[model samples]
Target chain A: MPNPDAGGHWGEFGGRFVPEALIAALDELEAAHTAALADPAFMSELDALGREYGNLPSPLYLAERLSEEAGVEVWLKREDLNHTGAHKIRNVLGQALLTRRMGKTRIIAETGAGQHGVASATAAAYFGLECTVYMGEEDTRRQALNVARMRLLGAEVVPVTTGSRTLKDAMNEALREWVASVEHTHYLIGSVGGPHPFPMLVRDYCRGIGDEARAQFLERTGALPDVVAACVGGGSNAMGIFTAFLDDASVKLYGFEAGGDGYGTGRHAATITAGQIGVLHGARTFVLQDEDGQTIESHSISAGLDYPGVGPEHAHLAASGRAAYEPVDDAEAMAALEKLARTEGIICAIESAHGLAGALRLAKSLEPGARVLVNLSGRGDKDMGNVVEYFDFADRKGQQG
Target chain B: MRAEAAFATTRAEGRAALVGYLPAGFPTLADSIKAVDIMIDHGADLIELGLPYSDPVMDGPAIQRAADQALAAGFRTRQVFEVTEAVAGRVPILVMTYWNLVERYGVDRFARDFKAAGGAGLITPDLIPDEAGEWIAASDEHDLDRVFLVAPSSTEERIASTVAACRGFVYAQSVMGVTGARAATSAAAPELVRRTRAHTDLPVGVGLGVRSGDQAAEIAAYGDAVIVGSAIVNCYLDSEDVPAGHQRLAALTADLAAGVRR
Candidate 1:
């Protein structure tokens, strides 16, 4: 994994910039986490749960059909094949273990993709903790199935209507809730973002994606993959897979952010590409902001990639030149999503489609045999409604040929 | 009209300093400006003019809703300067905001504008001293006060660092929650105030969960300045109309101000 600077910085990007009310809670969380890290019982229990509950070692597969189209040895890290159909399960389960450790019986979370919400609900159900999820009203409307899924899993889902009503707002509500309910609740942050120890703590739990990918890829390819790529919102999976390759100088990493329309159109969540360095939601990172230092509303077709800010570690990686980021426009991402399903029978989430789109762009310059691995972050089930409406699939299908 | 001067003046009067907060464009910029003047007339010694950013994580629903309305109404950062410039010198004013709004607006330029507009200092809810080397240096250059927060959870080392970095008074939290009024005063406030005073002779201001005069008086016993945010905003939030909100707010400010008198 890439070495973080002291005090939770990825460089100058990550630090705990939160209100006074949250500091004590963050300190308690950090102290508890530090002890848990050294405690073998905690590790064993977490590992056991990961194996039995999350179905760890999500397979690494070579996409023969995708390779031919891309003209590179394309591979897929099957995070989609995990328990929740995304990499989010890894994080929430770990946090659930920590919640139990801290003796916090209530759990709260913020979600954009609904993957994280579903994962949090799953963990809460497993542990029998009271679960409440804050989701953007727009996201709830787009990803209604996930909202139902969360409710089915025994979580109360709150639709936040404030400020563009997306991931950023949901996160803001979650932080507000955590501040008020810190005495009895644990805020299970879904990404490798937020303030001190959370960014680091989440990274610790989430590194398994990269760790498994590294071992699996090395065994199959006899060397590290030439490139590793994943879609970045808060950058949990991207950082998860990228960490395993951070120390390896030769293996390049890429994080593809959602360009909702395009960068120039001001409707996108391309924070690393279009954002300036600043603080948002507890951590100092790259954020989309107006010249006046106020955060701007970010847009994305994929709710998962619709955040105004990205993880601090991603900010540090970009600053340090360890990883590069690119923006994949909404149209381009959808096209790749369709292409991947048609070519390889893998209906990946639109979030993962951004990575596939970027990889396709990357393939045009590389030789046919060169290896590329993409974190297929999730399945397309929750996004079907959005996809259908966005593409006008039903209307088009209803029309006569 | 520096923050320290306001606290010192209040101490001389045998009362806890009454710090009032109003988000820059709540209801409207003109009304908010007029409202703060009324608050000052009633008894507010210091004003924390809130810059309404899109995500106000530290704020409660009342403040958050107000901020959302303000931002949605196109309350720009420059408008904060307008509010400060119009209301400055009447009372010591600090722009209470998150760091990103200041950073996205260049730190050097932000401090310069705030200072030029007669802003006494910043009460940054998010920016801590350790990560604030740039802000510290910039504030020093601009001769603006830097008010950092000290929570009950603050470690002794963290307290020392915050006290050293702060140029004005240290902002102490009365509770472990976002800004809002509560039924009872925080049990943790007195000890936190005593703990902070041990480190520095700088006046410690306690904020969060303070609403009524009874609550304010209890906190004022230990806190140098009792900061009221959500309670003040709730006047606007719960009122039938803007004018009523402003009127109720003025009355409440006076009530709280009287309670601060020893």
Candidate 2:
């Protein structure tokens, strides 16, 4: 709930574990973040950008069909309706603003599902700043539409072809690029995962989701929801919605991790559910590592939730028992996605579907009238290709729609 | 040969020490040990045996390629000590690795096993002084040297704190980038070394981008040691066969040694 101490230790999880060359830059970023938070002009500018550009205060819509199915009230915080069709735009806009404050002209980022990359590219285009995004070669293929979207937004997308060819490798490549260009380029980390200020910084930027949702839910129902749920990868969206409810002990929070095949199969990205404590991508957190501390490649049908490590704050939250995390396997998440599309006519990202699956399961255990809010983190338009392949839509009846 | 003694020996000869690096299982574990032997036999004053990690964010293309091959070939953390113990009698051996490997290996346990294996210490690229409390305690308890890095971007206070935690020597990163050979050495190296010297009497070794004898000689003029990695690793990677890698590694070591002595 509080900011990390001087050395960025969030109960011994988040610290700057990076090359000496990057220490100065991280320190500068931390200082700038501290300064910007206190500056009224900066805050006002960000708020205006959120309203005019990012479609701030995304709608909180009641899903009557989902509620009836779960025998409980269900509401969807529609972050999918935001600019760039994901929660990532909030963090990108915040970081892009900081990049300007730091007097940097170029920004670089790493992406998994390409939502973050596209959001960053969009922000860069708005600000007329140079942008480059590093995505794993595999993800570039899986999310080719998002890749093209980034390029069309005037950002160069570099395909990282290292170590598992996924989000982790893209981050590794971004760090490598940042090391050489630290003086003039800001590494606009897209998640609440990396070193020191990143986990805290990105979380703060995206916390608007929870802030607006909390107010709207309270205003509508005269009380908070019984549960809040979101998918956890690097955990930004989950953190974005969870932070506001941390103090409301009655409101239980759940983070659903991508369980590719299942927990037993060893081919999952369920870091908190099945992983051990270790360091990855600059933060000491729950990591899926081999016996010798080598990072094991994580598998997930949802590219956004396929990372082998979760955010440090989420690790701390899990360790402290403030929130519970569970694994939602590929089949369960896909089924939930199908249900949402059929019931509400809302096709959501596969990553968000994990949270939907977890929420549906949790809702069954609660009192019949208990309310649950799910963070729909992104739209499914970019995932149309993957969805088509998975469901084999061409073979299904009424495929024309 | 302990770290201080190794540097002292070269200091007595009025020359900088030549510090050479190679991953522990590149090519193969046996060939990597053989390569180290060839390096020492030729003229490497010290050895920094690399433990190829999965996410080597600080490595350049050459080292990344070799590390990838090493990891793919099933190289693990324990084999680093095997190579160190094999070559420790020839020169002081410092295991260069990321912090996660040591943390996962257990800090006290790693220090104990490494010390028992006749290894000198660690050169952790990611373990900056701010997060080095456990490592500092372990190294001290085990009487092992700890080498921390200083960079061109390091503030004066950071350099001082980094050197203060170091036991063997201070590593000065020549450039603001990952490790690889460059056409020219950094223009910032000399100033960084001078700043680091103001904090501690620890010998400063300049690393990153030094490949040729000319570059080695240039760094030797100011630095206490000249550290090279990618070029030496490239010797094995670019060679047609393992024996030829040994030949190329030995020749390069001798050239670097001559440059330091010049």
Candidate 3:
């Protein structure tokens, strides 16, 4: 329940841990964002773009078959149905509008799953601004479709092969790019993470997901669900959906982190669950780092969830006991992903599957008729190739032979 | 402070000090040690030994590459001590690091171990004054100098506060960007120095995009010291032969040292 200080500290967890050169740029961004939100003309423009371009008001659907199988009603806030097939568009579109407000013409972003990059590219195309994306080389290979999607949208993609060649390193490279190019460029961060204004800004833009789902759930059930769940990577969708329920004491927030091989293996990205609180990517939050404070590599089968750090707001919420976090392993997430596709016929991204898996478990503990809401943050189409490779569908043969 | 001593000596000589940088554990740990020695022997009055990190947001491609190579070669926090021990008594050595390393290594422990290794201080590019409670307290406990950076975009209030927090000379970034060598000196460098100077009687060192001797000389004319990193890192990174790179590093340091005298 603790709010961030005026200087952007989420109770010693979130501060501008950047060079002095970037203070001016972050100040400019924070000021412009505040001004834009306060202006009716700007807010209306952003809302119009959200409706026209991003296909806002993402539907909330009751997964009937899933409900029957689990003996509990499960509602899905379908962020997957957004324009870029993910919740990432909400942040990008808002920041893209902010870029114009700041009188900048260039937009840069860092991506791991490439969902955010594609979203940023889509916004840039709409706004007629030049776009560039920095993706870790490993992520580029893992999320090839999203890379091509960004490129096809006319955004230049730079593959960062530094450090672990993952999301953390890609963000470092993106910050470097921003420092040199801050005047004419806006770094369109895609998560509820990073330095000030970004985490808050991204959350504000995405709160519409929670707003819509809350209304839809109310109309159908006449009450809020007992539990609301979402996967946490850099944790945009989770923050988005959780924002609406912050004041509702009965709505228990559950954030599922990626437990790649499980906590014992030290290979997971379950930062809040198993890692220590430290600064990374400008935010002081739970991070997987070495004894020397160097960030350790994080592994996740779901590219979107393969990050070493969590958002600072989530850290504050966790500290206040307003939210509880759990880790869902890769195998569990994949099982839930396959199950959702089979039962609901609505494929879920591997990242969102973590939440689905957690929901399934939470439902068993609750009353049989209890309701649970999950944020389906992205579509599964981009993950089909990885799923096939992971389950070895290409190698599986019919037993009849 | 050792940095103050070096600056005093240089000022007495009627010249701005040549501040050199080299990433610890670069090329190889052993070669990195030799490189630092070469720089100090050639002309550097102050040494900024980079503690190689996994994510260096403030660094450009060259320094990042050097750090990546160092880290790839099994570098860790202990390696910083090793390099510092090897280069002790040559010049006032300041470990240029991002804040995470200190936080991870435990600020008190890092300061103690560094002081034990005869290190002068730390130049934290990321840790600013307002959020620098731990570093400031640790430095005081260890009696070690703590350097802070100021930029062209720094407000008067910021410059004043940053200078107030600094023990050594104020690091006045030449531009509003990360570390790298530039084709020409930033137009904002001299003005940034002037602004920081207006805030404090403390010496001001200019950095960010300063590459060649010509650029160093221009910065030296107004600034108290010229801190160069990516340019020195570039020497070893681009050289086909590391020994030649070592020679080039010394030669470059000598050239910059001469420029500071102009």
Interface RMSD of each: 1.6, 0.7, 1.1
Which is superior by TM-score, 2 or 3?
Answer: 2
- The estimated TM-scores of all candidates read 0.95, 0.98, 0.96
* Residue A28 lDDT (model 1): 88
Once superposed on the true structure, which residue ranges of model 2 sit more than 4 Å away at CA?
A395-401
For model 2, residues A144-231, the per-residue Cα lDDT tens digits are: 8889999999999999998878899999999999999999999999889989989999999999999999999999999999999999
Model 3 C-alpha lDDT per residue in residues A293-350, reported as the tens digit of each score: 8888898898888888989999988887999999999999999998999998888899
Ranking by DockQ: 2, 3, 1
Q: How would you order the candidates by TM-score, starting with the best?
A: 2, 3, 1
Reference interface contacts recovered per candidate? 0.82, 0.91, 0.86
TM-score of chain B of each: 0.98, 0.98, 0.98
Please name the candidate that would achieve the greatest TM-score relative to the true structure: 2
Q: Candidate 1 regions off by >4 Å?
A: A395-401
Among the numbered candidates, top lDDT falls to 2
Query: Which of the numbered candidates is closest to the native, going by highest DockQ?
Result: 2
For model 2, the docking class works out as high
| Deviation from truth (RMSD, Å), model 3 | 1.9
Expressed as tens digits, the lDDT of each residue in B34-124 for candidate 1 is: 9889889999999999988878888888888888788878889889999999899978999998888888888999999999999999989
